[model samples]
Each structure stands twice: as structure tokens, then as C-alpha cells.
Target: MYIPKFLEKDDVIGVTAPSAGYTEQVDLTKLESAKFNLAEKGYKVIETDNVRKCEKGRSSTGRTRAEEFLSLMDDETVKYIVSASGGDFLMEMLEYLDYEKIKSNPKWIQGYSDNTGLIYPITTICDMATVYSGNIGDYGMSLWHEGVKNNLKLLEGRGIIQHEFDLFENEYVKKITGYEGYNLTDKVEYEYISTNKAENFSGRLLGGCLDVLIMLCGTKYDKTVEFVRKYREDGIIWYLESFDLSAARLQCALWQLKEAGWFEGAKGFLFGRPCFFMEEYETDFNEAVKTALDSLGLPIITGCDIGHRPPRMTMINGLRTKVKFDGKHLEMRYTELDGK
Candidate 1:
């Protein structure tokens, strides 16, 4: 994994909706606010035509979004790219992307959820680093204060930095802000289920939404151990997260991965918040996860500040990193190919 140069102040950050069409359902005000936020940080925000189109309730058949993304990749001035939101259309745009062009000129591509489909394939084929962070819609509208700061740091090609881990402890209740009920606050308190201490471990960063990645298995995008060894000789670090999957389903996925030898040469594992919607299934979820890991005999860390939560952190796919674990503290440092 090669690290690209840091984005400069003059660099343009391209924004577009590749998966789902935003249309009217997208909050225009929030988009505008996000633009202002980026501008304030000394970036030139560029929004593609697909970002503004109202194609709500219709299928995402437009290639405009994919075309715009490819165009941005070729443009030297565009140093980074972010998604408007995650929807279920990126898989369709995979074949249309120019992988060679992206490989020659790698830039930061940030988003989560459905965007994982694109992120994984791009990283696998191009060997370029892309970010898995919050989308544009939640820019100024959401208060992921730590996430935003960390994202900017990463954009500068800085190493992974440790952050305080706080758990979401309360139930998120929907409130009536207008005639309809809305969740005014996005912050949720959580407990520290587990943490990876500050330590150094280097490998090509890989993996994404466990469910999505699993679904892609046997497809071109799947990064099976065999596929990974072809491009990456150092090893790989797997990161995963899920919204509200049952313990049984989660266990089945883990078993499949183990059987596939996904963990054969992995350095470690990072797990994001595994939020189970059913209150009664919390213990089941914990037990299933533990059972799966216990059988692997690999180092595992859970409850990272990523996925379906506020204050998200970005993981750059294909970037080699050194994670230092010091029992009470965790620190991540990067290394240059020249041994810097």
C-alpha cells in the first residue's frame, strides 16, 4: 500500500451521490452547510450534477454519478472525493469505473454503508487508499466533532491517532420537533466493550461492512485471502461493522469467513459498534461474537468508534498502518516506504 501526498489547501474536494439519488429527500440545507464547512477549512467544494438531481423513489440507473466520479479521479486538481450518502446502486457502477485511471491517480474516497461496495473494489483493484467516513449529508448537520477532526488529520497523510472511547448508554428516543417526530439529537452514550491498546502493527488495511463484503464473496470485489495475497505481501487488517443483525446471522457469517481462511494471515481485527435493535438479544449477540473469535485464536478488538454512530472515524483502505496497543492507551503511527 502506497500513501499519496497530503491534500493541499488549493485542492478541490469533489462531492457526488453515486449509489442512491438524493433528489428532494436529500436535505439541501445540510448540503449547503457542508459546502460552507469544507470551504472554511480551505477546500474548494465541487458538487456534480447527479448530486442535485431529484430521482427519489426511482431506481439509480443514471451513469452520470459514476461518470463524474471517474472524471474527478482523472482531474489533478481534485485531491479528495466524498459521497452524498450511501444507497444501493454503487454495485451497478463497478464495471463502468476506470480502474486504471484511479490506480494512477489515487485520492481519498469517503463514505460508509452502501458505499462499502465501491470502497472495497477500488482498494483491491487500484491498491489506492480510500476513506470510510461520514457522508456529506451529515456534515454540518451532525456533530461528529472528533470524527471530523480525525478525518482532516488523515487527509493530511498523518498516522492513525488514538481517541477517547465513550460508550452509548441510553436508548435513542424519537421526539416531536414538528407535526412528526424527529430525533433531534444524534449523540448516544455507549460503554467501552473492548479496546485495542496503543501498539504498532503494520499491514494493508482492508475489509468493510461485514454483511456487504460477505454478499460480494465469489464476485470480483471479494477480497478472499487468495485474492489479497496476490497484491499484498505484508498481510491485512480486517475491519467490520453492522447495524442491527441477529447473533445467529452474525455467527454464520463469521463461520463462513473462518472456513474461507480469511483470518489465515490477518494481523488483527477491528470491530465497530454492533448495535442490536432487540433488547433481549444483547447477550446473544455478545456470546455469538465471543464464540466466533475464540475459535480463531487471533488478536481482536471490539467497539471502535465507527459505523452506525455519531463521531465516526475514517479507515483508509490499502494504507499500511502501525497500531500500538499499551493496555490503557492506543496509538497508531504510519510509515513511509522509504522507512521514514
Candidate 2:
């Protein structure tokens, strides 16, 4: 794997809307605040022309978004690139993106949700690490949660020791309404369960939002097989989360991934809270997980505070990660292996 250089002080972060763009209908208070927060951190934040442009669920045309992304990656001054926001069909931009150019430049690209399409290709095809965290607009919140703060720290080249979140937002909020800042109203406790009482395990971190990951299964972008083959000895720890996939849908997706050889050498799996799920015929998240992946017998840890759920963890794809489930508390330490 090709790990890019850690970010430096005063480095430039180019924000491009490769998926969805901000528009007049959406409130700009948070976005403007996020920019201010980024500027206050002694870094320059640059938004491309289409960052704020919106039409038909995307900021602009796929070609235009791809061009902006390519230009930002090739720009020497811009050390990092983050998606403005996540939206539907970011896969469209894949056909227009210059993967060869990106492979040569190798800059850090970060985002989740719909941005999963870009993250997978950048890591597998281009062989570079990508950050899976909140979108750039999330930084607009005046009061940053510990999770968000940690995510920013990680993006700035600092290592993070992730433990557990005291509470997680059960519901999703599109436009933080009736609040001065981020309104994390509903509080739900975190429950981490391991299939086996495995105290410790290590592997290369991989995976993202299931909503988008499932869509890339059979496409040319599905490089999971090759990636797993190359890193089979090191092993792969998949940390997956759901955005809007139902329990039934999630089960099917998991089966599809299994058949596609996506989990050939997987050491373990970390599943986040489902954004939307149904207890179909007494089958829930756990049942779905068991029915689809029980045969593997790998340590399957669930109820992690990650994606779609508020107070998510920031994971670096292609980095070495150690997971510990000590009966009571679960913790993860992300690092780089010796000799790369």
C-alpha cells in the first residue's frame, strides 16, 4: 500500500463536491462555520467552483467534478482533498476520473456515505490511503464532539486511540434544525459484542458504508479480490457501517460480498448501528449478520459507533489496526507496520 505523507502545518485542503454540492435550499450557517473553523486551525481551505453548485442530486456534471478533483490532486500546494458532502451516484464520477494521474500524485482523499465509491478505487486501484470520516461540511458545527475533534486530529497527521463513545445519536438529522449547532438530542448507549471472546487481533483496516460498498461488488472498481490476495498474509479487518440499508438488504449484500471473495482473508468484522433496519420475522441486525457470515467463524464485532450514526470514528484505509475486546470495553489502535 502507498501511504501518503502526513499533513503539515498550514497545508492546504481542497474541498471539492465530487458527489453532492451545497445549494440555496440548504442552510449555509454550518458550512460557513466549518470553513471558519478550518481557517482557524492555521490551514488554508479552498472550495472548487462546484462545491456549492447543485443540480439533480449532484454538484455538477460527472466530468466537471472529475476534472476539479484531478486538478486539486495535481496541485502541489494542496496537500489534502476532502469531499464537500456525500450524495447519490458518486460512482458516475469514476468513469471520468483520471486514475493514472491520481496514482502518480497520491494525495489523501477523505469522506464517507456516497464518497465510498471514490475511497475504494483510490486505495485499491491507486494504492493510496484514504480517510473515512465525516464530510467537510460537518466541521461547520460550532461545538465539536470528541469524535469529530479526534477525526480532525487524525487528518492532521496525529495518531488516535479509539475507545468507546458514551452515547450515539440513534436517528439521522439532515439539517440540524431548532438548535444553535449540532443537535445530538437522542442518546443511545454503545454495546460491543464479539462472536468469540477474542481479546486481541490485528490487520489492515478496510471497508466503509455498506450502502455504497454493496453497489461496487461486480464492477471493475471491485478490486477487493486483488487487494486481499496481496495482503492475505497481513490479514484484513473490515469495519463496515450502514447508512440506509434494511436488515434484509444488508444480509443480501453480505452474502454477495462473500461470494465475490471480498472476505477471503478477513480476520474480523466491525459492524456499526444500522441507520434503518426492520425486525423481519424476528430477524434483526445480529440475526442478519449470523445468517450471512456465521460460516466464516471470524471474530464479528458489532454495535460499533461508526458511520451513519452520530459520533463516528475516523478510520484510515490501508493502515495497520489492532482491535481489543476485553469482555467489557473494546478499543482500537491504528498504526503503521514496520518496513511498510
Candidate 3:
């Protein structure tokens, strides 16, 4: 794995819209605030033109999005890149991405949700580490959340110890001033399928939103099989989350991945909070996960602080992570694991 250079003072951070962009006043205001925040931190921030354009749930054509992203990759001044936001059309931009250029010019690119369509493939194909976390606009909030702060620290090449947050915003909130903070209400309690193993374990990090990953199956962008196999000795820790997938669909998706030999060398699993799981069939999240993955007998952790929810963890894809979970709370320390 090729771990790209981390961000430094005065480094230019490029923001590009690979899936969707902003058009509304609220969104534009958020973008402006984010830019100001970065600029105040002594870092230069630049955004692609499409980041302010939105139409029919898309920022621009797939090729155009890819072109903008590549432009940043080719720029020597831009040391890091961030996705503007998540949306539905990012998968279309995969075909137009130049993987060779990205591999040659490695930079830290980060995003979550729909951006997984791009981030996941970049790591698996390019053999370079990528970030699966919040977008650039997440910094727009007036008060920075803990998760967001830790994310910045990690990007700055600093070591960070990530612990479970006391609370998480369980439901969505409407932003009035466009600078609202998280109203954390729910007590965080990470669920475990079986604590039957040890209290701590380590593995090379992998996985992202299940909603986006399932679609990449059988596609040319999917190099997951090769990725896991290459790092089989270190063991694989799969951290997965979902955005609106139901219980039935979740289990089926897990089964599909299992059948596809995607988890060939996986040592454990990490599940994040699902956003809008209907569970109409009365199949709860626990039952769905146990039915498909419990047989593997590896440690399984659910209800984690990740995904389309507020106060999420910054997951460095392809980095070796030492995870400490006493069943209720979780802590993680990241390190470079034999990238050569």
C-alpha cells in the first residue's frame, strides 16, 4: 500500500464535486464557511467550478467530475483533496478516472457515503491509501465536532487516538443559520455480536458504505478480491456502514459479498449506524448481521460512530489499525503497516 503524504501548513487542499454539488443558498453558504475555516488555519483551499453547480441531483457530467478530480491530482501544489459532498451519481464517474495518474501522484483524498464509489476503488485498484470520512463542507459548522477535529489531526500527519463519543445526533436536524452544531442526544453503546475473542485486535482497514459497495460488485472498478488477498497476512478488518438500506437488503448484501469471495482474508468486521433502515419485515439489524456473518465466528461490532451520521470516525482505508473494543465503547490507533 502506498500511503500518500499528509497535509502540512500552507498546503493547498482541493475540493471537488465528484457526485453532487451546491446550488441552494444554504449549501453555498456552507461552502463559503468551509473555505474560510480552512483559510484561517493557514492552509490554502481551492475548489473545482462544478462544486457550486447542481442540476437534477448531479454536479456535472461524469466525465467532467472525473476531469476536475484529475486536475487536482495532477497539480503539484494541491497536497490533499476532499470531496465537496456525497450524492447518487458518483459511480458513473468511475469509468473516466485515470487510475494510473492517481497512483503516480498519490495524495490524501477523503469522503464518505456516495463518495465511497470512488474512494473504495482508488485504494483497491491504485494500491494507495484513501480516507473514508466526512466531506469538506463538514468543516462549515461554526463549532468543530470532536470527530471532525480528529480527522484534521490525522490529515496533518499527527497521531490521534480515537475514542467513542459520548453522544451522537440520532436524527437529522434542519439548519437555520447554516452554522448549526450537532445536538447529540443518544448515548453511544457499541454492540457486539460476539466478544468471545480477545479484547483487542489489529488488521488492515477496509470497507465503506454497504449501499455503495454492493453496487460495485462485478464491476470493473472492483479490485476487492485482489486487495484482501495481498494483505491476507496482516488480516483484514472490514468497517461497513449503510445509508437507508433495509434489514433484508443488508443481509442479502452481506451474503452477496460473502459469495463473491470478497471477504477471503477478513479477520473481523465493524458496522456503523444505519441511517434509514425500514426493517419493515421485522428483521432487526442484529438478526440480519448474525444470520449472514455470525457463522464466520470473527468479532463483529455494530452501532459504531461512522457513516451518514454525525460525529463519525475518520477511517483511513488501507492503514493498519489497532482496535480496542471492550464491547460497549471503542478506541482505535492507526499506523503504517508495511506499505512497501
The number of the candidate with the highest TM-score is 3
Off by over 4 Å in 1: 24-26, 54-59, 141-144, 167-202, 230-233, 275-283, 326-329, 336-340
Cα deviation of 187, candidate 3, in Å: 1.1
Residue 275 lDDT, candidate 2, scale 0-100: 76
Candidate number of the best lDDT: 3
Local lDDT at 143 for model 1: 45
Instruction: Give per-residue CA lDDT, model 1, range 242-269, as digits (tens).
Output: 7666777787788877777776767776
The residue-by-residue lDDT of candidate 2 on 53-73, one tens digit each, is: 889999988889999998899
Tens digits of lDDT, candidate 3, 1-340: 8998878889999999999998878777888888898888888899998999989889999999999999999999998899988989898889899999999999999999999999999999999999998898788889899888889888887787888888888988877766777778898878787534557888999999999999999888889898989999998999999998888899999999999999887888888988888775778987788888988878888888888877889999999999988877788888662221
Poorly placed runs, candidate 3 (over 4 Å): 337-340
Lowest-sum lDDT 10-residue window in model 3: 331-340
- Each candidate structure's TM-score, on Cα atoms with residue i matched to residue i, is 0.83, 0.94, 0.97
Error of 1 at 10 (Å): 1.3
Task: Report model 2's TM-score to 2 decimal places.
Answer: 0.94
CA RMSD per model (angstroms): 4.3, 2.3, 1.8
Sorted by TM-score (best first), the order is 3, 2, 1
Looking at model 2, the pairs that clash are 34-140
The best-first sequence of candidates by lDDT reads 3, 2, 1
